[model samples]
Target: MKKTIAGIEIPDGVMAQAATAQIRGTESELIFHHSLRAFLFGALIGYRESLTFDAELLYVAAMFHNVGLNVKYHRSPYRFEVDSANAARDFLRRHVVIDRLIDEVWTAIALHTTPGIPEHMSPLVALISAGVQMDVRGARYDDFTAQQCDEIVQAYPRESGFKRKIIEAYARGMEHRPETTFGTVNADVLDRWDPNYRRLNFCGLVLGSDWPN
Candidate 1:
């Protein structure tokens, strides 16, 4: 959607990218796509949820968060976010995104990895980081692994603060499970395969509808 945030007129290309990342199904694609969604949702939620500046920064960070997924997948799977961060730095520099915003985006992306980093200096970064961690760990209150439950308890040792509540909410939201299997019917995703239904269109998330302007 062509929504303006922080006075910057964001284009649909960014939103399309977000959608593309969302419907991605590959193991590699799944994580990066979730990262993008988390960022977008985090960004919008940041404003809609708490009117926080950090959330806005996180939203921006999420847009470019996984730009390096392809590169990292071809290189080192574990380094996806790191490579994506470097790519983001370069892209932000060229695109004239302010240095502080670049730093915040980079921080959010870097801290989103499993066993996440928590050195974010802003509330937005902290919030996004916490949300991402919750998603990676487990979103369901009853679904937490022993280790995950321990992590949750440690992450929110106190059960009565704004941060704790926000984190809990994020965890709850990330609990949704999407259908990831490839359909044998008339699927048009980029990765669709059909020897019988060879008339099917291209694979991957289809960008058929007109994006928001």
Candidate 2:
């Protein structure tokens, strides 16, 4: 059964997939709820803005966007975004999804954490990032109506202490592969959780490099 949230229809087929089940099974309840909220908030934004996008693609992208935080992918050497992107790609391939659509979903997951760039990409890519920002940082929280927010949250409650849990999950995921966190927001998690963790300074790197004048 499909459901409409904020005037956006979430197809049943997308939600009933085995891959989607894997996400629900593997990710913490907090992360799973956050993912659903991201999609709902994204759809709400798209509806309000009248942005044309593939709803199913956005749904899948949002669902798997944080799968890298799951323990199964903790050891992955790449950034969590890349890991999640790969997982989504693999899942779509299993369903014999077309290459063009798979590429869009992959880009959406891969670049969801990236700033500025995704806004210039396809609607799916842009919407995933927007949804993530809304849920994670409340980037555009004020733009959403109180009633809309209430309904969305009521459907998928953000349990108490969600902020701390999400931060810890991010820290643990990056701690397993700290190197990947060097240049991203994941670094902030490491900085907060691991005092000894030092972020790479691009300016310092450039200055320290040998140069001939």
Candidate 3:
């Protein structure tokens, strides 16, 4: 059941799996749509930039990148990113995927939220971050043409109130584990939804460090 969305091909193997269906079934409609958009946008970027990558790996990474936000994973002590990575690893292992490729996918999902680092890593990891950024914040919105954007959104429409919905999702996912949001965009959600939440100050930490100069 390979299908093309906005000119990007999603392989049948990736789409046919039970785990993929579980993701679609468990995740909210907004999250599921966002995941599809991430893969399409990532593939488009790779094509535009003439970058080579493993499409299946990138697809798997994009699809399962946010599973930690689901309620089933809320109790895990690890950060949402790590939980998502672990879920992807377990899914891949069940299918007998090679360890090396599983490791690559795990890295892509785990580091997708971190800034500055994934862009310099392997293509699978770099594209996952790139796609997430483009979808979430329009970080590279200009890289895609108007038609491309329109088509992608049409295939996986961002329903009305998407901004608020996604923010709520983020808040719910990280609220119980505020410590994990300290250095990432997840912090913004906590700051808004949890009034008592205080953001960490990198400058203050730097100044407070013991230095023997």
Candidate 4:
């Protein structure tokens, strides 16, 4: 039987179970819990907004959203988000998921770290971002009622130092691929965490280009 939280039954099926199996134990308790909360929050938002989406797909995307932070992908040159998204893509493909839906999940994970853009895309994309933002920073903390919030957190509790720890997790994940964090939101992690890391100025890049100005 699938668990229910805040009146929402966690999506369950062979595929969903497979996704769960793939992520659990591979991720730290902190990151794993956050990922589950992200799915539940996204589901709650979808219910609140009456948005239609594939729960299974959203669940898979949420499960794999931060897997790039794992040690296996630490050597990947791309941003952690892209590595995570590709991980989901590969999983879905192994399950023979259709290209269209695979792309949707890919986009959701790849862009979850990106704020404004995902929210403007499809419901699946927007809800994925919404869920992640809510978990990572409480982007819409007050949107849900107290009961909803309590129920969700009750099902999956955020650790005591989640805010600080999550940033630490991001920093650890991308510290190896610092160059990838250059223009993305996670760059802030390296900026603050590593005193030696500095963001490359966009103006500097353009002006320093080979084009003789």
- Whole-model Cα lDDT of every candidate shown, in order: 0.45, 0.84, 0.86, 0.90
Model 3, runs deviating above 4 Å: 14-16, 202-213
Candidate 4: what lDDT? 0.90
Candidate 1 stretches greater than 4 Å from native = 1-32, 44-51, 54-56, 71-73, 76-78, 114-120, 139-213
Q: Which stretches of candidate 2 lie over 4 Å from their true place?
A: 14-16, 210-213
Clashing pairs in 1: 54-124, 189-203, 189-204, 190-203, 190-204, 191-203, 191-204
**Which candidate gets the maximum TM-score versus the true structure?**
4
TM-score between model 3 and native: 0.91
Candidate 2 lDDT over 70-155, as tens digits, reads: 77777889999999999899988988899999999999898898878998988888889999899988989999989888878887
lDDT of 4 by residue, 1-213 (tens): 978988888878998999888899699888888999999899999988999999999999999999999898888999999999999999999999999999999999999988689888998999899999998888998898889889888888899988999999999998888999877888889998999998987899999999999
Q: Could you give candidate 3's per-residue lDDT for residues 1-213 as a string of tens digits?
A: 667777888756744356558778889889989998998888888888889898877888888999998888777788899999998999889888899999999999999989999999988898999998899889899888898899889889998988888888888998888888877878988999989998888887788889853
- Which candidate leads the pack in lDDT? 4
Candidate scoring better on TM-score of 1 and 4: 4
Best of the two (2, 4) by TM-score: 4
TM-score of 4: 0.98
